[model samples]
Target: MPDLSPAAFILLQGARVFAPDDLGICDVLLAGGKIIAIDSAIPADIVPDCQLVDLSGRWLCPGFIDQHVHLIGGGGEAGPTTRAPEVVLSRLTRAGITTVVGLLGTDSVTRHPESLLAKTRALNEEGITAWMLTGAYHVPSPTITGSVEKDVALIDRILGVKCAVADHRSAAPEKGQLASMAAQSRVGGLLGGKPGVTVCHMGSSKKGMQPLYDILETSDVPIGKLLPTHVNRSEYLFEQAIEFTRKGGVIDITSGIPEPIPPAQAIDRAVRAGVPLAQLTLSSDGNGSQPKFDEAGNLVGIGVAGFESLLETVVELVNGYRFTLPDALRPLTSSVAEFLGFDNKGAIAPGKDADLLVMTPDLVIDRVYARGRLMVKDGVACVKGTFE
Candidate 1:
């Protein structure tokens, strides 16, 4: 059953509204976890029972969707104690992330796909939508079931497989192995009607995956299936990622690196390079461990990723980098939705989920709504996970 109520509440009067697709000045009618209408004004008769919120001229944009998150801890290179703990619900909600795609990082041995699936379901039960990738960085590829194909087809929340590519820390699959994995994921997606994306983790290493050129040369999967993340971490890597975009692949810029160049600058560089803004997406590798490796490839320093960086990226884009609000918001909002094949997310259209954020011109999140319910109001969360 779809939410067909005639806007139980109408948000009238916003100076600017980013419906995740474009910028406009219009009132949004929200009801029953879905956007019922977007019009100049609602009928007077429908106003009494509905809750009307006056925006006082603020920007309303679609809530953020983080694609490359370590949901249940993604460390272990340092030691057993270095593993990150499971992410808390309030951590994500307060950061304005209404949707997230979790993945396993280095320690797939200790943390199994079963644990990842359980954690995802738990988050979903708490009102935040959660999904996970099939495997970690290893070649054998750990799965809840023995096979990656089974995991993608049988597990409703499992979308695709993620591997470490072009990094010293990577399993570094040969060209043939990478193609076989992509074939398995593509066939599974076709069978289950799920996104068969092969999410790749690009690192700072200069020895890139020229091997993947084989899959690009011949494969039924569109280049978009290869979701290469963290492409903006290094200067050369960012250029490689831009070239990938030219080939129709979606590149994810991570917001968690503890480096000299910030995420906003990376985004600006991509824009100035003439990369399609729609082909780029941003994610806060939030709640994960950001390890700084010494020349010996050992962790010497570490920084924790902030859930708040998601919105902070928007602030830096608009304030520091001089990007228009619409330009800054598009990648984090609509671009992510399109990359992950989520039809109802990342938009404020009539039939889309009413997941939105209200913020001042200064980029402070004033309120948030997911599935058409008010979760945050006046910088505080009204709804929280049961675990919280």
Candidate 2:
């Protein structure tokens, strides 16, 4: 469980704060799990009992928000033994991910919605923010409340639903079915006061975004309601995603895609092609299986995704591609937090949750604070999950 001790004030000095906007050298004050003050210098005499840490020469940025993850484990395409293990707490904090959105993937049969919900709550208790989408690859997808609309409207943890499209594993529902699901998700989001987006898993099928286009052409569902992921899986799909973003829809690029356009390169391409940065986001399909299939449609090899890839991609965007720190920070931080409706996350301004990362000049995470508690200090985890 989260450390529930009486609130302690913390004063950090001499850090270059990003707020993701390069706030220059500043002193930040944290108390009661929130950022209470950020200034050029906070008077130490005001809070005499506060603990002070000298963060000179370190870079401080908001903690990352990974919008797509398999918290309860995903996969089972090969066999029961191939199901990936659940993600532990240290794995996320070490990678600087303070908030995560979990989902069921290809193996919705073996993993139920309740299990996903329980695991989300478990992560929250372990001291991080967590939320989830209700369904998985199958349409008429599995849910805790039996109906998609009811699931989002009633379940506080559920922000939306997910389904597979244009993939061999997907049920390949008709266009009308897709429209109905989108409608239900939209209504559920309206009732629940959340972004009831239908997160679509885009596969490498030749259909290539036609299903989404058909839905927009036939129904009244707005373009913003559908979020397609894995757009970097193939060049053709990536182009289609860029066009979708230009048309005011959001697109999510997965960090683990192999070959062709990698996540960093894809982001660069999107920026150059005039895609609005706000409409683009990146996610780590962490703890889910990354399978390779033979021409005959058999799963020949399987590998699991790691959460660290998310941070690695961001680092590459800055160090390798010459992106400004704030530009590289957008997709993983502020953009995602805004997309998911997390009011208190995504930035380091006052009144935001005290989820901040202290990184070395080279971008290695040196310390991590989530909700005013130090989770990692000097590259080592200070707090670990119950079973970790």
Candidate 3:
């Protein structure tokens, strides 16, 4: 029911725009899968036969860019039956996530990087934008190609590589290996026209972020190229995250974690401690298994992360705290776009992708757009996966 031609023009009028910068009330024009114009007023006739949608009371915002997700599902801690299900199209769109960077987690042996690539393509065809990282939690990380460099440079949809550390589940790749992989990813990004950043999965272990610091101290890898996620897992780890941020490394706070204080408060503590907000980002880690362990390292409980937390955390940052709308949106929007080196995303500006969201006064997602396509409307997904 949300069908529209790829090039069709749509005019949204009288919307309170966030552009993630609080543009006040404005009209936005969309065409050719890009935002053509944004101004105080644009007559309906400005573009001949453009479909006009009235949104006088809605808040228009840039759709979220969830940096960490398992598009083909991520799990396996509980056993073979615990692997999560593949992400369907509506699950992402309805959650207001317009773009995603997919990856594999702990079980790369059974789940291949090639399947993740296929899912990325599938998401694009399903009316949203998607990219992926190669490898899992293991060292000598698995790759579609024989090497990380080849995966990043040759694979069009692959942005870089992924690995884990500081937990019992990780391969515990040495700092030398970390530095080498980061360097390879950076060079691959240069060659492939993508941000070949290494996405490091941080676990809640006593080691915290020491491996990253060691890599920085002993190697030539730039601080910006390493993106450590799940920094909000514990209080002490969050402290290390602050230190890493002060040292100019980008830290990703996982929003789906429900323990050790809320992610919004963790971000607030970072801001109070003089950590630059631009260096911080928030991702859902959606579809990944969040397994809890006792002091004995036994799995006590588990839950699958979902895409909803990105929107929920953003709202909390504003209404529940001192953050302005733009500041609250930075992590999931501009900051993420900047970190991923995506030129056409993260803001509601002209020349950007038409990935916009419409929200009600109380912060419910009302309508959504991805690549200029109406993927969701009235808080429900209008499009679905092929098998759905």
Candidate 4:
């Protein structure tokens, strides 16, 4: 509503701030796409041209950061026709996701790293922060420059490499291959100054987490470097993840799980099981295909995932499970941001990017700001994609 463009100066007043850790009621000033000041009050005369908005009844928190998404769309397992469509900007902004980490899933052949990089740039152009991972489900995984190290080192937007392990669709790489990939990513991260994490897509296979365990037992790759996602797909997988987190590794829970343990419940279980809260993160897997396969590996049904589920899970954690607001917000915000090395994102503070969300008491999104630009106001999107 506030012109749908980046504001030179904007003041959000009287809001209960979360900085993702409850900063009490405060006035936040945004300028040059960063939070310049946060205090109990900011004199209007100090910045005569600043736009002032009273958010007395709203709750302000750091914008959500979704770590795993298919920006250019995922899935080709069923066929070319079943490839998920590209995600639009409004969907992300409306869902309170100000930053996203894009990746390719089962089909890196049809969807190239070039396209992923281009889409990430496109999102940034539209005023959202976006980064990506290289490779897909195969070992000898595809890369922009023919190697994982080169891709992470040279590509400014590429943060790490993504591959499937212990899944039916995975390359089923031997332990040596897994260690080599992990080493390459670690060195690349060190040289490039990026997180350089290996984002592994875990599956429903009975092998569970054995491959990752083998990698840890036999190699020097730090457990932190191995980020296994979709750990909540089943109770058994979730149990394995609980152990992994207890050992100082991080596990990513997908929001759109089908049955036994939904992501919110998974978090509850993980907390009860004594897994470190800081070691858990959540992702939407948005725009990726959720394909159900028969015993013979035939695709029987396919459903597209939605990014909105991330916020929905957060709300459930707070309102239904009685988790504190800050605890409910961590996995969606700071935890993911810290793990992904997004230094400027994941929190609302004086030096952080002006990515903030305003929510009503009932947990509905009332407004969203990304890097000092208002994208949604009063739960309505004011900005859209080039084609939307």
Best by lDDT: 2
Count of clashing pairs, candidate 3: 0
For 142-227, candidate 1 gives per-residue lDDT tens digits of 88788788889888999988777788888877766777777777777877888888887777777654545666765656787887
Model 1 steric clash total: 1
The residue-by-residue lDDT of candidate 3 on 287-312, one tens digit each, is 99988889999988877998888888
Query: Backbone clashes in each candidate structure, one number apiece?
Result: 1, 1, 0, 0
**lDDT values of the candidates?**
0.78, 0.90, 0.89, 0.89
lDDT of 2 at 310: 83
What does the lDDT come to for candidate 4? 0.89
- Cα lDDT tens digits for candidate 2, 1-388: 5473425899999999998889999999999899999999998866869888999999999998998999999888899988999999989999998899999999988898999999999988888889999999988878898889999999989999899999999998898888888788889999999888889999989899988997798788889889999999999999999989888999999997856789999999999999877888999999999989987889999989998888788899998899988888889888888788888999998999999999988999999988888888999988899898
TM-score of 2: 0.98
Q: Write the per-residue lDDT of candidate 4 for residues 1-388, one digit (tens) a residue.
A: 1244577889999999988888889999999889999998888766878899899989999999999999999888889999999999999999999999999999977899999999999898888899999988988888889899989988999899898987998988888888788778878888899888899999988888888888787778899989999999877888888988888999999997746688899998898888766888999999999998888888899989998898889988998889888999999888988888788988888889999999987889999999989989999988888778
TM-score of 1: 0.93
Could you tell me which 10 consecutive residues in candidate 2 have the lowest summed lDDT? Answer: 1-10
Candidate 3 Cα misplacement greater than 4 A, ranges? 1-4
